[model samples]
Target: MTEFDEILKLEIEARKKIEQAEKKAERIKQEGIKQAEEVLSQVQKEVEDYRKEKQIELEENIANLKQELETNFKLRVEKIRGVFEHNKERLKSIIYSVLGFN
Candidate 1:
């Protein structure tokens, strides 16, 4: 073959290799993008689940606190009742003694 024909054949082969390499690189880039999107989706789902769990825990804690407050109020009311009853008896005895009714 002439030198010109040989040169032309080599140029064609080089262009074919370059095209194949470009296609392979494009496929690798697409795959990387797909994997990154999947990871981001998983992380977002996990964050949402964590938020829901914490919200439930906070609600339960609030309910427990309200129950404790109600119990404390009831105990305080009973103590106040006892004190008032004792005061009434003491007042009655003092009045009887002062008026000579003892």
Candidate 2:
């Protein structure tokens, strides 16, 4: 065969190799994109779960605070009622003195 024919054959073979490399690169790119999408989906699910957990925790804390407030208010009201009963006689005497209702 002539040198020119040999060179032409080499050029064609090189072109075929380059095409195969491009196809392989395209396949790898698609695979990478699919993997990234899967990871993103998983991360989104994890974030949703974390949000639900935090919401439940917050609700529990709010309930606890409300119960504590109610308990404290009841205790304070009882103490005030006791003081009023203890001062009832003095309060009556003061009222009569002020209005001259003795």
Candidate 3:
């Protein structure tokens, strides 16, 4: 064959290789995009699950704190009642002495 024909054949083969490379590159790019989307979807689902778990935890904590506060308030009220009961007799005796009723 002539050198020109050989060069032309090489050019054709090079172009086919380039086209194959381009197709392979495009396939790789599409696979990468698919994998990225899958990862993003998984991350989003995990984030939603985490958010729900945290919300439930926060609600439980709030409920526990409310119960603790209510218990503390009831205990304080009971103590106050006890103190009032203990002072009642002395207060009456003092009032009678002040008014000269004893």
lDDT agreement with native, every candidate: 0.98, 0.98, 0.98
Model 2 C-alpha lDDT versus the unseen true structure? 0.98
Better of 2 and 3 by lDDT: 3
Residue ranges of candidate 1 with Cα displaced over 4 Å: none
lDDT of 3: 0.98
Candidate 2, pairs of clashing residues: none
lDDT of 3 by residue, 1-102 (tens): 999999999999999999999999999999999999999999999999999999999999999999999999999999999999889988999999999999
Q: Which candidate gets the maximum TM-score versus the true structure?
A: 3
Ranking 2 against 3 by TM-score, winner: 3
Clashing pairs in 1: none
lDDT of 1 by residue, 1-102 (tens): 999999999999999999999999999999999999999999999999999999999999999999999999999999999999899899999999999999
lDDT tens string, model 2, 18-40?
99999999999999999999999
TM-score of 1: 0.82
